[model samples]
Target: MQQTKRIAIIAHNNKKNDVLEWAKFNRFFLAQHELYATGTTGKLLEQEIGIPVHKLQSGPLGGDQQIGAKISMQEIDILIFFWDPLEPQPHDPDVKALLRIAVVWNIPIACNRASADFLITSPLMRVEYQPYLPDYQEYLNHNYDQQTTKVRQEQPVSLDTA
Candidate 1:
């Protein structure tokens, strides 16, 4: 239900192609949203896919840091980082740390093509945040508390009640 004003995309060495393919597949959804990406990946997407992408430096060359900063500032909504699971990246720690922050922020993220598809295809992707959605987190937390309290109330009143 959110505007999803901005989204950041990143891809490891081996996954750039995969991300590009997915990007092309979602060009319609992407065109309506602002896009951010690392140097090479952004360039490729812009050149081949014709999508305007705000380019950061190469991930290993401080681009990841830039994206992390945006994430912390709540300037980013969705993040898609296609990681190379098999290869060892020198900047692996930075990637992990950035992902940790995304989790903490409760941002919607798509690490692979499948998840990305689901997210982009969701009916709410381009819709404005409904009144109920804006406070969904708080509502969920309160509901959880009520459910726990109800469980306690329904517990045996006494060991010898019968």
Candidate 2:
């Protein structure tokens, strides 16, 4: 409903604290926009930085999938994911998928604190960016609309045999 940019935060185990610290130092800049993040990361950000965040689930347990869906739906404008480069994760598939979606949606992505820092201070973020994005919903809605129409065409049948 709100037209303000939606920024999502997600961090790997090794970088969660780093992300929280970065958020704390940049709280004033981050407070002006809507924020979302994975469950633990969101909770930690709140407890440590005092910034509210809409929480999803843990990334290994479908949190990335949740945010990916939002990105596909054009609901997310920025993605700040602080991932661990030194460690490999079993859920890399989901993490990669989330990042891929961010690229496909043309949303700005920051994978580290430095990038996030630069992003939080950028002037463009405070401005509207809708006009720069291409028309996309028509293609995305094709399957949903077809399924809805098919469902509507089918009449409900009541069981009369007893």
Candidate 3:
């Protein structure tokens, strides 16, 4: 039996329609997996596609951060984000952060329709494929040790007769 994958879908305002169409085309396949989305996107998918979607806050209202947190926690397996490159976003930093976290966690991310198509059609999507993930704890420990050493090197020695 194939494990049910957790997938996140997000799209910019101008790309919502594109994502909707894509979702409609893949509705049957999508139904087999768990779905999550930002507020408006989730509502539209549930209403138009008749598929249940767990809705997070709107992107500008912290939805991207919420997704990023899920990726870090290893709760999300795939991310389909249809972001508009031509337009500037109010929460651009959040969007970049979310993408960065997804990369860091080794989550499979599809930024456009073509990538999504490739990912969806891959046989690995239905099977359990192990992805390499960086050891965040080890990274944190290394950083802490580096900082401790740096602080020690910067500290000044006290003179006698203090």
Return the TM-score for each candidate structure: 0.77, 0.79, 0.91
Sort by TM-score, best first: what order? 3, 2, 1
Q: Highest TM-score: which candidate?
A: 3
Per-residue lDDT for 33-70 in model 2, tens only?
88999989989988887767899998988999999999
Off by over 4 Å in 2: 1-3, 135-162
lDDT of 3: 0.94
Query: Model 3, stretches more than 4 Å misplaced?
Result: 153-162
**Highest lDDT model number:** 3
User: What does candidate 1's lDDT look like per residue over 1-162, in tens digits?
Assistant: 357568899999899989988988878788889999988999998987787899999999989889988987778887888888899999988898889878766777888899888877877777875422133578789999999999999998887856
Clashing pairs in 1: 1-129
Angstrom error of the Cα, residue 105, model 3: value is 0.7
How much lDDT does each candidate structure score?
0.84, 0.86, 0.94
Output the worst ten-in-a-row residue range by lDDT, candidate 3. Answer: 1-10
Give candidate 3's TM-score.
0.91
